[model samples]
Target: MGGVGHWVVIFAIGGAQAVLLALALWRRPVNRAANRVLAAWLGLVGLDLGVKAAFLAAPAPGLFRVLLFVGVFPFLYGSFFYLYVRTLTTARRLAWLDGVHLSGFAVAFAVGLPALLAAPDTNLANMQAWLAGAFPPPVPWYSPFLYAWSLSYVAAAVWRVLRFRREVRERRSDADRVSLHWVMAMAMGQVLIWGIAVVHDYVRPAGIGYFTIYGAVAVWACVLGYLGLMQATVAGDDTAEPGAPREVPPDPPAAPPAQDEDARLPEVQARLAGLMEDEAMYLAPALTIAQVARRSGYPEYLVSAAINRGFGCTFWDYINRQRIAAACRCLADASDTRTILDIAYACGFTSKSTFNSAFKRETGHTPSAWRARQAAA
Candidate 1:
């Protein structure tokens, strides 16, 4: 590591922040299960940072041994993140079977335990020799496995996030709020950090300090802590109602709805249009397909199909288009005199950021820019 003292200070501060964030997540009321998983991950990160800091500060044989032990713990981060994503997206409790993911960590830890029992002088000598650029016997045998496990699990988490986003769009108007985009960013950030660590480990090029790797980790810790706390508990497609029984897997494939049933889609489409245009259903910020179906006296699936086929868009796009149109009219009305945020709320957007994104996507201009253009024109 290049600035050993500075790196030590950085690691100490990061470790403290991570542990504090972990405690906060543990105490947070909402999203208890997912938060707890995140809390555990942060706690492990704190412990890892502390070990690295200690090793950097002293480089003692005992500290070096402990560092080796903690080194294998990185294997657990991927599993923790994957579990966190699963819990949030599925709203389900983790079962005992999930312990299988820890096997890699356990195996590595068991294999490296013998290093601690070796003679202290011999371990110190080896540590010194290795730091001095001499190859040694215990040559990071776990690197390949560690990289594969972590990357694969992170990929799986990203997959779940994508699926969750699609499902949310189909069900709720406030899909942007719970889309889990942050999870995708965080996972990719982890990949980047891992990439840096890999280059540091293998290349060991001059001027590219070890501290740079951990510094990226420290920054990532801050981002992860903030985003994980702010993310809401995403309800999945299979989420059941208060008194509803859990759905079981249907047996095998079934035929699609007949053409006769499809022929009535035009009527359903008209009803949906009337609901949006006349009833202003899109103005309900928390509107859902089930609510739309109830209002239209149609089944939810049929309502969804009508929106998909008749509107040539997903339910989310259809609803957001209506919202954007309403917002545009409001923006053009000089006499309305509502703040953009106020207009966003009135037009069914839950947040200014979400409103801004949808508005720009539909109009090719931000709300403010659009209003300015209309005023100038």
Candidate 2:
């Protein structure tokens, strides 16, 4: 009964992943490379899970042990994830050097071929021994190579996600623009699972570690599926083309003759205020300091400094204050009947959670409570 229950869980997770992969692959206009890479990653995960389920249900010798080659997929899947992040963040075509990341899997397969081709009796004995906590001697170079290769790629993926976050924050006021928070969470989840698995291998050496690792993989699949479906585009999809020259902001006008730092500060502050107030550029949702700088004909650093010195707050705080102020007007207007979410979005918020928190921080009342008080008055 215990074995049956385990098989059931495995198959269920595998089946769900398969369905998600198919939907992602077949879903719409076939233009997005990120979607394709994501689908491929899901496909490999599903394959890994399916192989595990089959091997556990009926632990055969020759075919099942050969199927164990699929175990190397953690390395492959990690590469796929790295590529997916690259695609989303840069939209660059895969480079030839990217193939080098998979060299570990190739080496492992080459080293394991002899064991896979051994007689059925021999393979069966090996499998039983492994299940009994008797791991075979590590392949001369392949074991350490796979470990280092896989760990490096996972670390790279985490770094890529962190870089993506910083880039987005620099360019846009909306932090959730590409749902990068979810991507970062997924990458960190992989790191944690991999780290724990490594420790378990050294300390426990118990076969139960396989179940724990695969179980985490299954959960990771579900999370990726949910986030992938929620995302309309992985990133802005307006990434600069590979090797294309970036558009430089036209240089700010020369400083007026003899204009000291103190004298020039107000001019910068006024221009920033004009952009935020008269144009309502703050409602752009992704407004960034660099953007404000470009539009105001000021250097990025000067723009940031002006906001900090003149407004007495960070760029994010100043922008959110404007958004909250706009939200307050909409909330107070008795003629406006739009839902809070609609108002939130119209006022440049990307998500309701952000809207609520900012509104509360700035106004000291939730939108609903503030709206109620206004109505009563």
lDDT of each: 0.83, 0.74
User: Which candidate number maximizes lDDT?
Assistant: 1
Candidate 1 on 1-377: residue-level lDDT in tens?
A: 23579888889888888999999988876677777888999999888898888888878887887877777778898989999999988877778999998987887777777765678787887678645646243446767777888989999999999998898898889898888888988898999988887886789787555578777787788789888888765754433333567666445334357685588789999998899899999999878888898899877777877888777788888899999999999999888898999999999999888888889999999999999998888
Write candidate 2's Cα lDDT for 190-264 as tens digits.
887777677766677655465677787887887776666666554544334435676555766555444465568
Q: Give the TM-scores of the predictions, in the order they appear.
A: 0.88, 0.76
Instruction: Give the CA lDDT, 0 to 100, for residue 355 in model 1.
Output: 88
Per-candidate alpha-carbon RMSD to the true structure: 3.8, 4.9
What is the Cα-based lDDT of residue 224 in candidate 1? 90
- Provide the lDDT at 110 for model 1: 76
Instruction: Quote the positional error of residue 343 for candidate 1 in Å.
Output: 1.6
Model 1: weakest 10-residue lDDT segment is: 235-244
Residue pairs with colliding backbones in model 1 are none
TM-score of 1: 0.88
Regions of candidate 2 where Cα sits further than 4 Å from its true position: 1-5, 12-16, 19-31, 119-121, 130-137, 140-148, 203-208, 238-265, 286-317, 329-343, 361-377
